[model samples]
Target: MEKFKKRWEITQDWQLLFPLIGIIALAYTSYKISNAVISKFGVIAKVLLAVALFFILLRFTLFLFKKLENKWILDQKWEMIRVFIVFAITGSSSMFVGRPVIKLLGITKENLNVFIYWILFIIIGLVFYQILLVFFGFLFGQFRFFWEFEKKMLKRFGLGKFVN
Candidate 1:
């Protein structure tokens, strides 16, 4: 535990939650991807594939950590993990929440052109993504980081005036 904390630069107990959540989220994502790729396979196959993907993803994430370490402004190295987790949750959740919203608005492929429905879906997802990014960042104790991120994003979208 000491080594783990030292490696992550974590001094507080609550900061430990980020690593634990990162592992669980990564494992769950790995399993979901494995199942999608091998729907007809048995449990053993899925488990093995998930394990392979987990390690691959872990390696890729580490690579990203090294690459992003200097690019992003952060006080602690452990905060990078928290920022990533917030991004992961916000991205997945935006789509999940957008589905119900699209349905409620009676938006469907059968009702509209396939292309239009998809376009609307993407737009709605983006809106939710923006909102959820800040929301989850606050929940994860990175509100300032994500708020600044959101402002930049809005600026890129030509909504900078609103942010100001």
Candidate 2:
């Protein structure tokens, strides 16, 4: 535990929560991904797949950490887990928020063309995602990283004039 804390630069007990949450979230995601394919497999197979995916996902996350470490400008390596959690929450919340807004706007798959409804849904979700990303970033103490990310995203969408 001491080694783990030292590795993550965790000086306080409360600061350890983020990494724990990150691991729990990752394990759940791995299990879910495995469950998706479990209909064709037996129980033992599902367990195996989940374990395999957990390691694979862990590896991918570490790869991302390695790649983004230099680019993200963080004071500590552990902050990446918090940033990732905020992003995950923001993305999931955006879809949930957009769904109700779409209904309130009297737009639905039943009324609108399916393709058009999907396109509008994606657009609305993306807009809400932008807002929630910054909100969650501030909440997670990584506002600077996400603010820069948001600026770059806007520039990519040709909304640079507004940001500037």
Superposed model 2: Cα runs more than 4 Å off: 40-43
Q: Which candidate number would show the highest lDDT if scored against the true structure?
A: 1
TM-score of 2: 0.91
Q: Which stretches of candidate 1 lie over 4 Å from their true place?
A: none
CA lDDT of every candidate:
0.95, 0.92
User: Candidate 1, clashing residue pairs?
Assistant: none
Residues 1-164 of candidate 2 have per-residue lDDT tens digits of 99998987888899999999999999998888898988688878888899999999999998998898888888988998898899899989999999999999999899999999999999999999999999999989888888999999999999988885
In model 1, the worst 10-residue window by lDDT is 140-149
TM-score of each: 0.95, 0.91
Instruction: List all candidate RMSDs to the true structure.
Output: 1.1, 1.6
lDDT of 2 at 50: 91
